[model samples]
Structures are given as C-alpha cells and as structure tokens.
Target: MIIKTPRLKKGGAKNVYLENVSHAVTRPAMESRRVQMYLLMLLADTAVLLGSFVLAGGVYRDQWPNEFAMAMGWAFLPIFLVIAVYQRCYSIRALDEVRYAIGQAGIALVLSAMLCTVMIFYAKAATEFSRVMLSLALVAAFAGMALVRVVMHLVLRRIYGPSVSSVLVVMDGGPKVDIRGAQIVHAEDFDISGVQSSPNSLDRIGRLMRGMDRVVVSCAVDQRTKWANVMRGAGVRGEVVSTALQELGAIALEREGGQSFLVVSTGPLALHARIFKRGMDLAITVPAVLVLSPLLLLVALLIKLEDGGPVFFVQQRMGANNCLFDMLKFRSMRVEKLDSKGARSTSRDDDRITRIGRFIRKTSIDELPQLLNVLRSEMSIVGPRPHALGSLAGEKLFWEVDADYWQRHALKPGLTGLAQVRGYRGATETENHLKDRLEADLEYIRNWSILRDIKIIFATARVLVHPNAY
Candidate 1:
C-alpha cells in the first residue's frame, strides 16, 4: 500500500519547520561562537576559584587545608552554582557587558561566602573555620574572577578580530547604510506607498531572515511598528534607523565612517530573569488571591444580582507566545447584543455599560476576576495587557493597525501593566495610541525585575481611577 503526505503550503507550519531545519544545517560556523565563549568563561571561572582557595590556604596558614576547610571548599561548588543562577553570572548578555559580569560574580562570591559562614556557625564549628582565611579566600575569589574575565575578553577579541554581526536591511526607499565589517545578507527595496496594501511584505521578510543575526529597518515613522513586528516575529534583534533609538537607554552603538548603527536586543528576557519573574508572580499572586477572596466573591454577587446575567465575563484573549486563553472579568456591560468581534471601543457616554459596570470599570473592579487567570498560570499579575481577538484601535483590528502589536504577547498578558499604569488604558483612539502602548509594553519586558514588578503594583494604586479607564 502507498500513502501520500499532505502538500506543504508556502509559509505554513510545515514550511516553517523545514525552513528552520535547513537554516540550522546551513548556518555559518561562527554562529555558535557565543556559546563556545560562554563555556570557556565558565571553565576559566572554576579554575580561578579553585586557585583562589589554594592561594588563601597557603597565604593564611603556610599549609594545605585541614579536613573541615577541604569540606567547605567542596560545599562551595553547589552553593555557588545556585548563587550564580540567581545572579545571572553565566548569561550570554553578561559576556557583552564585562562590568555587569564582574558585578554579578562579586555578588555571587559574597553570597556563597555568607552561606559558608552560616553553615559553619550552625554546626558550632566556628573555631575551625578561620575568619582570616575565609576573608582572604573571598577577596581572592572576586579578584581572580575579574582578572579571568578581563583576560578572556582580550583573548576572545584577539581571536575573533572585532566581532561583526550579520544584518538584514529593510528600508522603504531610504539611503543605504554603510556599515564596516558587517555582512548585509538581504536588502528589501521597501516602498512606503505599497507598505499598507502589500500583504506579502512580511512573507518576504521571513524568507530574507534565514541565517541572519539581526534586522535593520529604516522606514517612515508611521511604518516603524509594522516592520518592528515583523523582525520580532522572525526572532532577530531589530534596529530602526531613527533618532528614537537614542531615547532607549543603554543600546550598543556601531559606527562605520560617517554612519552609525544602533543595535537592538530583541531576544526574550534572560533565563534567570524569566525564572525569577515567574517566581515573583507566584509569590505575589498566591497571597493576593487569598487576601482578596472576600472582595472577589462580593463582586461576583453584585454582577449576578444586576439583571441576572452571567456573573463573569469570560472572553478569549491573546496570551504569551500569541496563544489564546480565556481571560476572566466581571461582566461590565449590559447583556445586550454583545459584539462578538469586540470591534467597538467603549466610550464614557456609551450606553452598553451597566450601572454596576460603570462603577466597576471606573474603579478597575471589573479586572479583579483576572486574579483567577493569574492563579491558573494563564497570566501574570504584571505584564503586557492582553486584547480580545477582534479588539480594534479604529476600524482596523489591533494586529491590523500595527504588525509588531503581536510582540506584546511575548510576555503573558497581565492584570495591570506599564501601559495601563502610565494612562495608556481605555480605548485606543488612533494608530499612534496603540503604537505608544506597544512601546511601553516592550520597555517593561526589556527592563523587567522583581523590584520593577513591585513598583508597578504600588504605582497602579495611583492610576486606578485614570481618566481613560472609562
């Protein structure tokens, strides 16, 4: 018997899979240099740490470590490993920022030394744990780590000979950039007149991005978001040729002749940061739900009593990775003919809102039910706000208005976000309004921290009754 497989459509899932495999097989050998550098640094760090212990033992006592000191040295390995993870000592971006790497390593070493001290004190073995020796070891560890990093940076630079990233240029009838030592694999002749009507532009971008390290988009201000979305979805760092790049803090700058290029880091948060963020979410969400349980119940009762409609409004919303999930909210509209497409934006004087809905919407009480969504791990307490499937800015759908709009979904949708807290909430009036919202969302992702999340939470109280919430 013979069987036939379905034909793969262009740019379809099967095609994307095959293209990914091809790119993997054909990518330049230099692509893995970053990973190789990371391993080399790790090994170098370990060697220096061990040497630090040996030097400390000899300098402090003129002899090798005793049994307890040897045990402490071995114990330091796993403790330091955990500390390094929290400190992001091994992050790839850390390699790019030597100062950051040194600071993180210092923090890790101090944390590990503290743990050793605590363990020694707990066992009542402080007499055997020499404070002078331990202090010397800690100092040596920090100095050795910093020295290794500086040496490795020099070595890698000499070996690699001034790293030049490969970039794809997407400019709509703009002057070409002259970047030295950088490879321009593809340059699309984008036309501003055709951008809006042309549907295949993104498809062309996807094809051009194969084996590319970065994408450079030089387009009109209006079309920036569209290209940004495309580069983000293609999973490459996106750099726009505009003065706005300078406004974004701490971006790398590359200069060649008279022209300068801004390097954007479009990748997801560091692994350690993501884990830490998720941990923070659970730590806050779990207790928050428990504390707000009574208020949640009361809100539900009020919704149920008002006109006897469904107590909760469950709508399909875009979540992390552009996945769809049912987002929960207290019903905030009169159960009239609801717009299944959610194309209509609510206005202050609009009559679809119920009496209770008006108060809930004003007080942001309608969003409380999303705590349940947070508890289920479908959302975070702080992230980019999710939009309903057919949510609109004007006549066009949200995604239709700006291509990069989907990038906001890279992080799980939140109950409150940077955009919401900054008064970008309520109905989006123009394309620029939605674009600004995306900017805020991306900013949050770029600078995410546990402290930032806490700060946003506290700051949210000030914007709970925002002018735009209606």
Candidate 2:
C-alpha cells in the first residue's frame, strides 16, 4: 500500500477513488474529540466559578449566596469564557500542554476579573458588593479551574493515547515520509494526482482527508503548485514536501527527522487577530454608514439626476486570495464611456467623467459606496486596495510589472490603505508607481496592528481631495 503504482490503460490514467483504499486506516475523529473536550472544560469551569462564589458567600456572610453574589458569578463566568476562548484556553494545545492550559486560564481569569471590576465601578455597584468576598471567589475559581485542567489533561492523555492529531501523508511519487501513527496511502491508489482538476478528483481527496487534522503531500516538483492550490481551497492544514522554498513562496520551513517541507498556505491572520480586525471594522463602518447615510443618499441622487445612468459602477477586482469580487463605487463616468475593464487610467479633465463625476472624484466622495463592502466583509477599512482586472502599470499588467504584486491579496482589499494615505493614490502610470504602492501594501500586511489600521483610516481623511484625483 505504501508504493503501489497505478495500472495505466492505453490512453489515460485510471481513476482510483478513496473508497478503494478505505480499509487501510481507521481512527477516531480528532475534531470530535476536541469538541467534547471543549464542552467538558466549559461545563467544569462554569461549575467551578459558581461554586466558588457560593462558597465565598457562605464564608463571608455566613449564608447561601444572595442575588448579588450569584449575579457577580454569572457576570464573571461569561467574561471569563469570552477571554478564555480568545486566549485559546480550551484549544487542542491547551489539552496537550498542562502549563499552557494553566497559564492561559490564569491570564484569562485575571483579565476577566479586572474588566468585571471596572464595569462594577462604573455602574456604581461596587459599594453594593463585598470586595473581599469577590476577590476570594476569584482566587478560588482560578485554583479550581487550574486543578480541573491538570486532571482533565491527564485523563485525556490516557484516553487518546500519545497522538494529539491525525495526520494523512499522501505519497505521490516523491520522497517517502515516515510520520508516526499517520495513515500513509500511495496517491496512485487513491487517484490523487495534483494535476487532477475534476470535481471527483477533489471529492476523492476530500474523502480521504475527512478525519485528518493535517494532509502532507509528497509529490513531484512540477505538481507542487496544483497541490498547494488544492490544499489552500480545502478546509484543513496542508503541507507539501518540497525543497523548492524560493519557488513556492513558502511562509515557513519545517523539518521533521531528515525531511524538509514547505508550508505554503497557513492563513495570514490568527483567530484572535481576525476577530479583532473584524470588530474594529464593524465598530468604525457601522457608525460611519449611519452618520454618512444622508450624504450617500445625496450622492446617489445626484449621480442618477446628472446622466440617468446606474447609481453604482460595479467592476470585478482581484480580492483576497486572488479571487474576483464585484467592488462597488458611485458611478462617476458617462454611461457610454464607462470603462468596465478599467483599461485606461483616468487622466486629468477626462471627457469620460461626468460633470458631477469630476466633483465627487475630486472630493473622493465616489468611493463612499465601498463602506457597504466593508460591512459585507468583502473589504476592510485598511488594507491593500483591490485593482481592476485589466489595470496596467506602464505597458504591462500589474502582475507582470512585479511578481510580488499578487502577494498583496493575502489581506482583504481596503476602501483606503497605507498606499493611498502616503499619496500613492490615482494612476499607476509607470512600473515604479505600482512598485511604490506595492511596497507599502506589503509593509502593511507584514506589520498590521489595530493601532496602525486606525492611523491609516485617519490618514485617509487628509488625502480625500488630492490633485491627482480625476
């Protein structure tokens, strides 16, 4: 089963499906195990929190917990859960490593307690509750949660044995990888060629990968890109065994035993970072939309009244992961001369732009409709700007001018970005113009923070009426 070759017919390769090789491996689903563990920890922590508060009430007031203590318990429990989830306190790693579990639990508990205390103080309810009793309950809750994690870790280790995850190694005529406890199948046996693009090909690969936490494909150099694309589109951690790190644009290099593999597609942001970015986007975009709705309405009405054309100028642009999406903007071009493909950059006093268009373009009001894109999660308030498909830098397409241009799509396209704020707005008339913006975009991706995003959003306000705007 490790090195079985597919039997070729006269004209084509045989299609070997996943079911043909199903008997080779049988293992418990790692995802289900993690879910059960998460549920158990949630239940355990809730009990510990409430019980701690009740016991503290008995010690302090010499009675069962009254409404205040129980209320405090309920409040602290939700806060702790939110912080704990963000801190990955109930993650698979926490289950595996006792120290990490205890540390994250402690940090989450302390942060949640501090936040709860601040809320109480602001609500003027601090005087109504006993501080000593609250402090005592928090201390007891932390101790109990820590003890629970340690016990649960020991029990889970005994239950699941040594393997923390299920890994699938698909040997596709490359180097043979020996991963302990991993189910190894010859790619030919499963008809899993990296070049196979048929729906059934993906279905077969997915079925074989169903319960696996990670899929490692050891394939020929030429097939690496296809396999990487397949894995990127699939819902699992995928790695390809390759020494061509430079060609693959490998984010990180991994070495296990004597084998070196290139990790092509881990997501750009972590879970907590995604949550933070999305929260910030909503925080700003929702209020901005509400405050600017009347202005948006006015702009739409004017555009419609000027030329009786469509309100929006929707065009396909490259978005995150090089996918195309319809980006919206207020129509600023004459109906007949509208450049849907964006073949040419808008020059100063261009006839294609309507009289109303010129004013909105000058004031940057034409871009206001993209606020909806931000709300839709199709765009961000701060990111690399999405470009029209036919956008050119000098005589070449943007990608042809610089290979790294596509790397900017790793993050969501923004309504405004570091490049725009730095006066890289308007046309990319030459390769250097594109290069400068690309450099800023890549820099933003590399050093992203909520503070930086806020700063970019603020900076964008200054350049709303730049001279380069048509």
Candidate 3:
C-alpha cells in the first residue's frame, strides 16, 4: 500500500495571520543620534569633571591636577559608565519623558556623587578639590546630558507631535481624525502607531519617510495580542519597532542591535539558569520555612476550619526545569478539579472559593505553603508567577502578550513581583492586561535588585489592605 503524506503550505496557518499585516505609524528616526548623544554625555561629563579640577587648581594657584588626581580621573569615567548601564541610565526607554529624564539624571547624579565622594574621601583628595567646582561639573553634566532627551522630544514632536515620531501614518477607523487634540485626536497621542486601518496608508507614509524613521504599530482601537505582535515585528530594517503604548510611554523601548534583542522570554528560565536559581531557592527556602512555620500552621488550621476539606491542596504545577511538582497550597477551593489547567484567577466571588479562602487569597496567606517549594528549591520569592503549563492557553490569556512574550520568563517564577504590586494583582486580565503585567515583571527581572524585591514585598502588603483587592 502506498502511503502519501498530506501536503502542507510553507507559510503554515500562522503565516496567513501575519502576511496581510502592514505597519502604519513610523518609529522615531532619532535612535542613532540619540545613542551617540548618550555616549557623548557620559564621556563629556567625565571630561568636564576632570577639566574643572585642573581649572580650579590653575585658578587657585595649586599647580595643575596632581598625579593622584590624574589617576582618579582615569578611573572615574569607566566607573560611571558601569553605574549608568546598571541603572539603565543609557537606555532610551529609561528617558521616557522630560520628567523621567530629570528623574533618571537625578539618580545617575546621586550615584556619581556617592562614588566620587567615596573616592575623594578614600584618596585623601577631598580637601584638595574645590567643592563648588565638583558640584558645577555634576550640574553641567546632568543638564548637558538631559539636553539630548529634550532635543529628541522636541524634534520628535515637531516630526510627529509627541514622544519620538518623526513621521505619522494613521489608519482608517471610526471617526476619522479631523483635529489633532480636539474631538477626533491623532492616534499618536495614545501611543497607537499603525495606520488607523487604512490599506496603502503605510506605503504612502513610507514613501514620505524614505525609510529614515522608526516604524511603530499604533493600535487605534484595542489591539488583540496577535495583531500587536505582528505590527511590532513589522518595523523597517533599522528603525525602532514598538507598541503605541511603548512609544507613548517613551521610556524603555526594547533594544535590538546586531544579534542582541534585549527583551527575554520566560521559557528559557527552566532550561538555562536552573542551577543558579536552585541555589537561591535553597538559601531563601531554608530560612523562610524556618521563620514562617508557625504562621503556615495557623493558616492551615484556618483553611481547614473555614471549609470542611483537606487543609492542603496539592496540584501539579509547572516548576523549575519544566518538571512536574506537586505544588502545595492551603486549599482555598471547596472542591478541587484535577484538570484545572484552565482554571486561573480566583475571582471576587468564585463559588468554589470558601469564605476564609477569600481572605487568605487577598492577604496572600494562601501562598504561604509555597515556602515549602522554596525550601525544596522549586520556586523563588521574586520571579514570574508559576502557571500550569498546559492550562495557561498561551501567555495571551494571562499576560499583556507581544511578539517577544515568552522572553519574560528568563528567570525562575516568583511568588510576587513588579506585576502584582503595580495594581495588576487579582484576576480577569485580558491578553493585553496580562502582557502588561508580564512587562512589569520582565522589567523587574531584567533590572533585578535586592531593593526592588523589598519594594515588591512592601507593595504586596499594601495591595492586600486596599479595598480593591477583591
């Protein structure tokens, strides 16, 4: 018998969804120059600082900067650059707006001051340097650096209104925009990038731009997770590609240079960095379980009394290395279903949730049992939320998904994070909503810190008390 394999199209079903897609709004043309500006600012600021010291010495007749000062000068710029990268002070997205520029510059300056102050004190160079000169150099460095952002905003506004649009391509949608800021405002204001939906609009706009500017997908109306990914991926070869919201927020646009696309996905967390995280889990779990045992027992009793069922609910959870682990939680549901792959988000009045379960979930007392997993090295205190792998129905259901959605999980899952505290906690978030949450989580992980974890823990507590927790 001859068996024939059925023919499959090269594009696959997914291609049909993408091929018809087009880019409408243009991305900011300022990326190249802006990068140069950042480098120049950092370097120039250091040069000015050293120069100011030499000038101060000349003016005060102390003989041009000593050998010790010269050595410090050599160390200063590189050290500041490291600090800037760590703080993401060089990131264009970090400079979201004029206000954000000031804020970031303030942070960078403070960091510089700390380093400089420490160096001066240690090197016994504090008395030798002019305080006012150092301060002036810092002020000049901050202002000069901030000027790049200011110019970028102004040039971009002149080009496309606000944010960093050097060109605009509006799609056809309900109520065509008649006036920029009036009844029918331009779609760019909302950070919506693509043509409102007008076919050939992008082509016409592309001709206008000569491919000089960035290409953005400005979703005029709400964008489904699928479309947002398509449009964001459609940026011109060299131009920036981002969502309207990102363009509007104008603070941390995703990076792509050579082989490096800065945004990370969640899948690799289970694969690449398992050992490093397992060590952290051992450290945290050992101490946490030791400290919170009494609270855990009390919570278990409360759960048992509130609902006449087993105190602990063991469900198969997607754990580190993508292995199946019987994740334990104080049973909050009256009756648990084995195939709850799809059941997520304990609602305000989920019938299955017992009265005490409601309180426990709101207060996050139910998650106390996960400390056992932490002790066992199954989870971390601050990472992405562990979702049932099969049940999640793709990230769109639980995250504000985009083309690079999976990149959010490069690290192990966390019990609480940047998402949970920023008013994104609780449930019923659509695809975009979850993606938004994941975005925050991604931001947290990419810029992880001990301080940030502390902040998240504090915010989680505050969210528990707020009336909106339900």
TM-score of each: 0.51, 0.52, 0.46
User: What is the TM-score of candidate 3?
Assistant: 0.46
Q: Which stretches of candidate 3 lie over 4 Å from their true place?
A: 1-36, 43-78, 82-290, 301-310, 319-323, 333-358, 375-377, 387-412, 417-419, 422-458, 466-470
Best by TM-score: 2
Candidate 1 achieves a global lDDT of 0.73
Candidate scoring better on lDDT of 1 and 2: 2
Model 2, span 387-454: residue lDDT tens? 98888899999999987888899999998899999999788899999999999999999878766898
Off by over 4 Å in 1: 1-271
lDDT head-to-head 1 vs 3, winner: 1
Better of 2 and 3 by lDDT: 2
**The 10-residue segment with the lowest total lDDT in model 2:** 1-10
Task: Give per-residue CA lDDT, model 3, range 252-324, as digits (tens).
Answer: 3365564533332323434334555566557767887789889888887887777557888777765545456
Compute the lDDT for candidate 2: 0.83
Candidate 1 lDDT, tens digit per residue, 1-470? 11112334455664354344334322354467777777777777777777677777877767765454455556676788788878898765466567778888987988888887888789998776778877777788889889887777667556643342444555464446555334443232222234346565455445556556766766677767877777777677777777566445436777999998767645667798778777888898888889989988888788789889988888888898889998888888878845555678889887898888888899998998888888788999899998878777767788898766777887888989998888898787788788889899988987777667888999999999978887
